[model samples]
Target: MSGAAAAAPVRRLAVIGCGLMGGSFARALRARGLLQQAVGVARSAEARARAVALGVVDEATDDPAAAARGADVVLLAVPVAATEATLRALAPALADDALLMDVGSTKADVVAAARAALDAARLARFVPAHPIAGKEKAGVEHACAELYRGAQVIVTPLPETAADAQRRAQALWEAVGARVRTMTPQAHDAALAAVSHLPHLLAFAAVHALAQQPDGARFLELAGPGFRDFTRIAASDPDVWRDILHANAAEVRAQAAAFRAALDAFEAALAEPARLRLLIDEASRVRRAWAPAGAPPSP
Candidate 1:
């Protein structure tokens, strides 16, 4: 099918988690008039109630099966660890031709779990996805419809993934104003380990290490915009990051090693005045040159 023909409009969407990402996706869909109706599934009654109250979905239910029934698209937004369970619960209710997608940070594990949990006949409809955009702050309270504007969304299609399903998945994200890009599951995971996961780990570590210092409170009080900017991602949900790190352990471990070696090199340079000056100047020049123009002024 042609790309346009492959991506039929999504009439109804089911979001499996009513947290920040899921909530944002629902809101974005509504803003763009992409879905005739949206249903939400949360594990707790309170979460379900909140999702409905927030108007992120037309209906909210604690039962995944009920929420997923008859959905044209099902977006799995739960934590990576909870993905398999959620998929299993929704499997029986999912429409035979529904497009199934996810927003998990890591891909390999989630894709494998989906293969195991979903029915073999419906495997072709599963389009694994990850949106490369989010703030450190999470939860529905922090969710906004414009969160994904101009963001790069990675779509990972497995051997079993159908062309139509992939196209629909891409259109879903594009409807929310994101630029979709295709990547292999391996490449996506490896690239994210270096650019996304590793930075989060370092930010968390930096904040933790600083907090452990005797004068940390005083130091923090004096911290300027630089410190706040650097530590922003550290404020992300610990539970989510834990799942992401463990899910992509091998890649994360390698990234951590490479980061440590870079840190060591910088530390060694500090003892040599000329080398330190050279490193600082080079970093400044590169950063200034690459910085985006017309970007919002950093706070």
Candidate 2:
């Protein structure tokens, strides 16, 4: 929704989490020669080592602040729950002109974290971003340079965000081969709750419901492609999803209420043949007409 002039290569890039999202970003930018140096920080020494060993980043460290120090750009790619603590650690070390952004799944909570953790100047440098791209499998080992190619990235700039930071945020994502869409933090959370968060919740719940059955194992043995496709996201990292679901709990709850109402309508329609056909037809039309951004339409 917003546009910025192209940014030249940066001096340094620092990533706080150095996991799937963070490592992938580093790889993407490195492929483009966008930074003179790229550093990564993570709690797991093994992961940090893997990042450097895989050349996802030029260097690695355990201290987030140490990695952030002197960096021209910083990406907080940790879990949404760890956002505040990570920001607190990095803020003191962040250079005044440096731009900071996050790859968080949710924006409202991350914006709240930024407000609580950073001073006015530091907050001004912070840009909240969510790249709508990932694989079901997550880890530094799975990081790829092409992961964000053609994906849509949501940029939610706060009122306090500096013009330079916003511009850089837009440029950074575009450089990584992602299309950018700007949204207010509240709007981002509300809309994502209905489309993304609610679907993940349903996938997780459906799998749990299936596994809880006495014939769960037997049922699984006979499962087909439809079951596999529907529950694929249930295989997502539990801890990561837990943090996301909790961080956006209020929005997710509101969306869930709407989902229940939809379910109620479906149930009522099931009792009437004509109404059932109408409901199915409407849903089919909507689904067939829609496709993920950058995706080819269904045949």
Q: Report the number of the highest-lDDT candidate.
A: 2
> What lDDT is obtained when candidate 2 is compared to the true structure?
0.88
RMSD of each: 2.8, 2.3
C-alpha displacement of 51 in model 1, angstroms? Answer: 1.5
Residue pair clashes in candidate 1: none
lDDT for each of the candidates?
0.85, 0.88
What is candidate 2's lDDT per residue for 1-299, written digit by digit as tens?
12213757878999889889988988888787776899999788888888899988889999988999999999999889999999998889999888999998999999999999999988999989999888788889999887887788999999999998898888888887889899998899898888888999999999999899999989999999989888888889887889899989999999999989989999998889999899889999998888898732322
Q: For model 1, what is the error of residue 115's alpha carbon versus the real structure, in angstroms, after optimal superposition?
A: 1.3
Question: At residue 74, what lDDT does model 2 achieve?
Answer: 96
Q: Assess candidate 2 and give its TM-score to the true structure.
A: 0.95
Over 4 Å off, model 2 = 1-5, 295-299
The count of residue-pair clashes in candidate 2 stands at 0
